[model samples]
Target: MASLAVSLGLRAADPLTNLVGIPNYAPAYLAFHFVWAYGILSSRTLKQWYKLDHQESPRYDLVKYGEAAVKSGKITKRQLNMMQRCESASANSVENYTFFLGAIGFATFSGVDRQTVNYWGLMYTAARIAYGAAYVLIEDRKVALVRGLLWWAGNAACFALLWAAGGKLNA
Candidate 1:
C-alpha cells in the first residue's frame, strides 16, 4: 500500500487503483504480499523449532520436563541457547514486518487511492497468514524455498514499480 502511494499518487475512491496507471498497482500489491510471506515463514519456523525442542532433548529420548531438563544432566546450555536464538529470530522478523507495514501506510496516505491501498493491504495480510501456516505445516526444503521466492519476487516487483513511478512523480 505504501509502495503504491509512493509510486502513484493517492486517489479518492479505490486505494488499490493506481492514480498514475494500472501497472503501478502490481508492484505495490507484490511488495505487500512478499512482506506477508516473510511473516508467515518466520512464524512457521518458530512453531516447528519450538515443538521440536519443547520435548525430550535433541540428543536423547529421555523425558526431562521444562527447567528440570536444564537442571538435570539431560540437556546442555548450548541447546537452550539455540532455542533462545530461534525466539530472537522470530522477534526480529516481526520488527521488520511492522516496518514494511508502516512504509505501506505512509505511502498510501501520501497520495495513493484509498481502495487500491486497502485492497493490497488485505491481500498482504491474508498471504502472510497462509504463508505462516504453510511454513509450520510443511517442512520440505523445496516448498520452503518456493515460498521464499514468492516473497522475494513480491519485494522486487515493488522496487521496480517504485522506480518506474519515481521518474514521473519525483521529477
Candidate 2:
C-alpha cells in the first residue's frame, strides 16, 4: 500500500492510485525540452548557413558572421546586434527549461498528485514555447506584452505545482 501510494505520487494517507504507474511525466517534459532546444539551436544554425547561401565559412560564430556581413555592407550594424541578441535569448531559454525540468522531477517524486503535476508541467512547457517564439520572432512593441504574459503563466504553473505538493503533505 505504501509503495503504491509513492509510485502514484500520493501521500500515504491521501488515497492515491491503486494501479501501477511510474513517474512518466518527468521524462515526457524532458523529451519536449530537448526537442524545443534543438529546434531553437537548429534554426540559428540554419540562419547562419543561409547567410552565406550554402557556401561554407571558416567562422561559425554568428556575431562574427554578422560582423563580416556588416563590413561587406551585406547587413547593417544594428541588424548584426539584433542577431546576437536573438541567439543569446534562445540559449537562455533552453537553460530556463532545464531548471523547469528539475522542478518537475522533484514534484513528481515528492508525492504530488501526478495528474495535477502533469497538467501544470504541460502548461509550463506550452507557455515556455510561446514565450520563446515571442522573444525570438517578434520584435515589436507587442512582443513584450506577449512574452510577459507567457512568463507569468509559466511562473504561475510552477508555483501551482508546489502548492499542489504542499496540499498533499501529511502535516
Winner by lDDT: 2
- The collision pairs in model 2 are none
Model 2: how far residue 74 lies from native, Å: 4.1
Q: Which stretches of candidate 1 lie over 4 Å from their true place?
A: 1-89, 153-171
Model 1 TM-score, all chains together: 0.42
Put down candidate 2 lDDT per residue, 1-171, tens digits, no spaces. Answer: 767676686744343533345344767877877777666634465456547333364234564466788789876766665555566556766777766776776677677777777788889988888887776666677656878888788878878876776666744
User: How much lDDT does candidate 1 score?
Assistant: 0.46
lDDT of 2 at 130: 82
Report RMSD (Å) for each prediction in the order shown. 10.4, 6.1
Steric clash count of candidate 2? 0
Residues 9-107, candidate 1, lDDT per residue (tens digit)?
453433444343344343465465455445433333433543434333432222334346567755565555444433443454455465445545455
